[model samples]
Target: MKKGTRTSRLTVFVVTVVAIFAMIGIFAQDVAKNTTLGLDLQGGFEIVYQISPLQEGKDLPAMSAVAESVSKRINVLGVSEPQILIEGNDRIRVQLAGVKDQEEARRVISSTANLTFRDVNDNLLSDASIIKEGGASLGYENGAPVVSLKIADQAKFAEITQKVSEMGTGNNIMIVWLDYEDGDSYVKEAAVAQAGGEAKYISAAQVKSAISGDCVISGGFTESEARELAELINSGSLPVKMTEIYSNVVSADYGIGAFNKTATAGIVGVALVMVFMLVVYRFAGVIADVMLALYIFAVFAIYGGMGGVFTLPGIAALVLGVGMTVDANIITFERIKDELYAGRSVQNAVKEGQSTSFATIFDAQFTTLLAALIMYIFGTGAVKGFATMLMVTVFCTMVLNVYVSRFLVNQIVKSGALDNKKTWFGVKQSNIPDVAKRQEQFYFGPFKKVDFVGKAKYFITTSLIILAAAVVMICVNGFGGKGALNLGIDFSSGTKITVTSNETLNTNEVRSDFEALGYKPSRVQASGDKVVYVTLNQALEQDQLTSIKETLTAKYGIEPNDNVVTPVVGRELVKNAIALSLLAWVAMLIYITIRFKWDYAVSCIVALVHDVAIVLAIFAIFRMEINIELISVILAIIGYSINNSIVVFDRVRESVVESRKPKLTNADYKQIVNDSLDKTLVRSVFSSITTLLPIIALLLMGSGAIVTFNFAMFIGLIAGTFSSIFIAPQMWYTIRTHVKPKEKKKKKVKKEKLDELTIPGIND
Candidate 1:
């Protein structure tokens, strides 16, 4: 170690990190001023649109063309960041986050997308009647004028078609129509149609059939009927028929309750973690606790600086990460205890402890980093947000908890500030044999050196089978294309609403009655018996609103609070999410390759893919609906799996440096891996357990869509733990087996390369 240059290196590292913070802080402030606000914090308009299903025997492409057209139309409304998506087979949801005016949003969405009618000559014609009522002319139909109508149904079509057919020999049999007065049901009557016209106009029978799909027109219609017919012909049906299956408007009070509970949970978690670490390691633990506090500050700074949204899942990641913050300190402290037990002076023990723990810490952190990268790439929305926050926080945690904490403790010990060994966390000097100095070789009893090379074929075959099965299952389920995993309304099309009132009410009664009215209720779960979650199969249509209200009002004895937010999935959004996920993994793999050996990087990435496949497999097998929520858990798993691999590699690197065995085959070196796994097993399990707690809470107590996301993480964490310990170490051993031992003359040349493979003292 270059003693003189060490201080300069440390100074540079600190300065660089500080500079990053300063720049981020400046950008964060700018973002707060410029960035768009999400719908949650601000009151926004919730737009629910329906997807029109394909008519039987029709040549149309069903929902596809409608979806594309609706997206284009919505884009014209200038609703930036509006989520417009197709849901299931028949629905399109358009959610405009941060839209304040419900009426304004509705006006934009409720208008007919477009209605173009081609004449026999392929010429265009304009209708003045429908255009006056905010109706736009689509085109011409059958050598006549065709206009887009905003009428509720086809009555306008019938009147117009009848009048158009009765042009010349018009009789005085005037058909009276009505327009309802404000807040009144009765309509003021007026003549809309007259019976009798030339035979050139469409017949009654023909008009009826066409009006079934689009509105029809007839000759000799009065001003009112013609205008009404124009509106009907112009207004197009929704791509999918929908009902407000679920809506819950979070009242100010409920939001406050949720916020308080979440905040309390976070504060308690941090306090408990800090207290536990300080109590266990005494003086050294104090240093770790100080760093833990610093880590918290750094996490906030990074998130705020990055303009990272603090989503619920993101909160969970931070809480779990907090519990695991002291992991590096624990490893280091344990090493120091062992060194002190071996009759080393406090200063030397501190030095050795720091040196020994570096590799273990790096390995553990690196594995977590790998997982974070993978999740960030593959996940959408909140999942990516969580991954982004987790990766940044993990890096910050490592720096503070490992380096800063260690420095403070080590320097204090080295300065003779803590002269008495007994005072240093009550650590009394103890006599123990020095394993490093011993001439005798230590061995775990009865463990055979199994020849992995002999079993390579079987190993390869088994791995291929597992990998193949995963791919086959995904493909068969259409999980790879179309709709593999059940996508929630957020990613697909549907309406989700939550409503809460101070008065207690029957959630089921409200839900069932709504369902009975053809509201397409997907789920009705109660949060704390007072809050009811209602999910609809599709977005609610304007016509269904009155019926939905009547049903809820009848059942609950109260008008249902409709805080509706409809999110639609677009093809482009889906494509982007997939591309991002793939890109994340590719980018991470490239980074790993540059940092380590290409082989190691590839192995790590494959292991990541393996983890992701298993998670998706579980989802597909169980019919778990995919959504943005699941993305968060997947990201967390990536970090966990990679952390495990790094730990094993760290130990393997250490063994390469220290082992003097003449017959040190890859199998003989297996103990190094076992030792690393053994050392990490406790911390890994503990971290997983802590991480599971909030997810369990969320599963039992949180939102419906979020549960699936938590489950993904729950499954991923367990799988990641298993693969990291059992699979990753085995991979390293297998890879090393392929590296042939050099000839006696080439040994010197090989040593340098081997040294390159080994990161010295990293796994101390």
Candidate 2:
């Protein structure tokens, strides 16, 4: 290369680094300011409603209209930018952030707002027919509180009033009813006129003339009641009845604390990953570190741009993205190292390594993206948020870590500054073999001599034993009336009470207190310094809920926040979780088969199942809560395991394609498999370690809400690494040997013969 060209490339590299960091700095601040926080990370409440037909034999239309009605009602509570989701065929979920009056908000949302006009004979004249949409207001009628309504059809209202006026002298009256109930006559309604009844009789005015356009109804209503009635009327009536089946309320203090702790953990986790990369890969590592910074910026910028709500789990995903970025870089760098060890020129190594690793990277990222897509489709609330962030993370890692990092590293190589100094690429001069004698074998640190294939039976046997024990545990739990596993409120119908006291509370003491009250809680734990979370198997009634709250408040000097989930929602969540897992497995299998071959695809699926089973086995043995977060962890494990398997399989394919011999014996094939495993073993271990670091940090220091989630991921990462190394490749080898080995050999020979014949006339 010319000196001037070298200097130009170096200058461009310097400029690019500066520009990337500057852009990141600017976007980071923007994300912090503009991004919305979810209820779990902000003081708020969320309610899930099961919409039923108001009458028999009436089916609802997937709750879209009901969601809109509820959204309007929530807006009346002064909540800005509320989240309203229509879930499935008969449910709507509403989340309101920074709502101060929980009771008032609940009342405003569940009101029927069925306005009706009746005659003295209790005959229906009009029902929600005379009032215009969004035209009801609280006003004064002759110095008394009244609800004023704007008539949608003035002519029709006039006819009704005229008919009432024509009645006999004793019956010439019009009546107004708000949410009129059955079995309540005008006599009982008249007795409860001031405070209102189930059939709120607003007014019974004598009609002397035809009234049209706008009218006011007054019947001793207070200012607050009149205002509420007007708001409900303006919001429109819900077409179906919304029964609250699940709800969660978080206090501002808890939300702020969780956010701070999780953010701190993320910072620490990301910093450690950056330093590890810089120390391990040297110059290439520096490039990776810069790209990682940009990766973080991209995730936040895209998330904020899409108006995504940030939650605690979402933050964990961002932290996890750092680990994923490290994995991508390690895959590329390891391939480059292999090329270097094969005595390739620095420039040639960089080019070929990137080209070869691209397939593995794409396959890995796509499988993870598949899982995230399924989660987004089947998940709810914070789980959905986590899925969205995971998708964003995968996208940014591919763009920044794979392509951008490759481009930058190639520029440095082209500069020719580190031509002789292979140490900068983390390779020793003594390690590079002579070009003439180069072979497919390469050392993976101290693991070069490890016979991973020979010990496959032991690994497989061990995994089966553990899996069997897990099955037995679940079966025993089921038969013993303890349930299949320790199901959280998210997976079972239950109430979760989160109580914060003035000081740190003991978990056993809290459990004993609940037990003394004849309430055998399913689980109890003390989170952080002052919060105790308790889960009960049965849903409490309104009075029972109030009693529990009051008792806790009196004992602990603070009111407890409560969350309730019905069995209906829990059953639906479990069903969706199972469906999502199956879909992810099938999608990954199909993807791998298309990218490589069916043999590799089946083997990858087996390895994935192994990893997930191990994680579940540990969870069962420990009786950990099986919730939606565990489902996310399981999907993550699938992605991670497949990622490692693809790396090993890619190497195996490369080995067989580059072999010199026309036919391979059984021993030769075993050597090929073992060599491939040895080459990728270091990369697998290093990547898993880097990934597990952040998860460990989260487990120890992050929010207690997600500790179980992080712990599951931590175990799954180890198991995935093991399966990818020991099980997946061996399974592929066994399957390939048993299915049509002679056919492949014949095809190879026929192709060689055709190559040798090569049309004599063309050559001559």
Full-model lDDT for every candidate: 0.54, 0.82
Regions of model 1 farther than 4 Å from truth = 1-101, 105-254, 305-308, 334-338, 341-343, 356-380, 417-487, 499-508, 522-528, 541-581, 593-599, 606-610, 613-625, 661-663, 686-705, 737-764
> What's each prediction's clash count?
50, 0
lDDT of 2 at 71: 82
Q: Give the winner by TM-score.
A: 2
Q: Which candidate is the best by lDDT?
A: 2
lDDT of 2 by residue, 47-121 (tens): 988888777798775566787788888877878879998887877888887787778888889877777888877
Model 2 stretches with alpha carbons more than 4 Å out: 59-62, 119-121, 141-145, 152-175, 181-186, 189-213, 219-225, 433-445, 508-519, 541-543, 740-764
Give the TM-score (vs. native) of candidate 2. Answer: 0.90
Clashes of 2: 0
User: Can you write out model 1's per-residue Cα lDDT over 271-373, one digit (the tens) per residue?
Assistant: 6666665666688767766666666667766676665655456666776676456667776776676555544556677888789888767766765676577
Minimal lDDT window, size 10, model 2 = 749-758
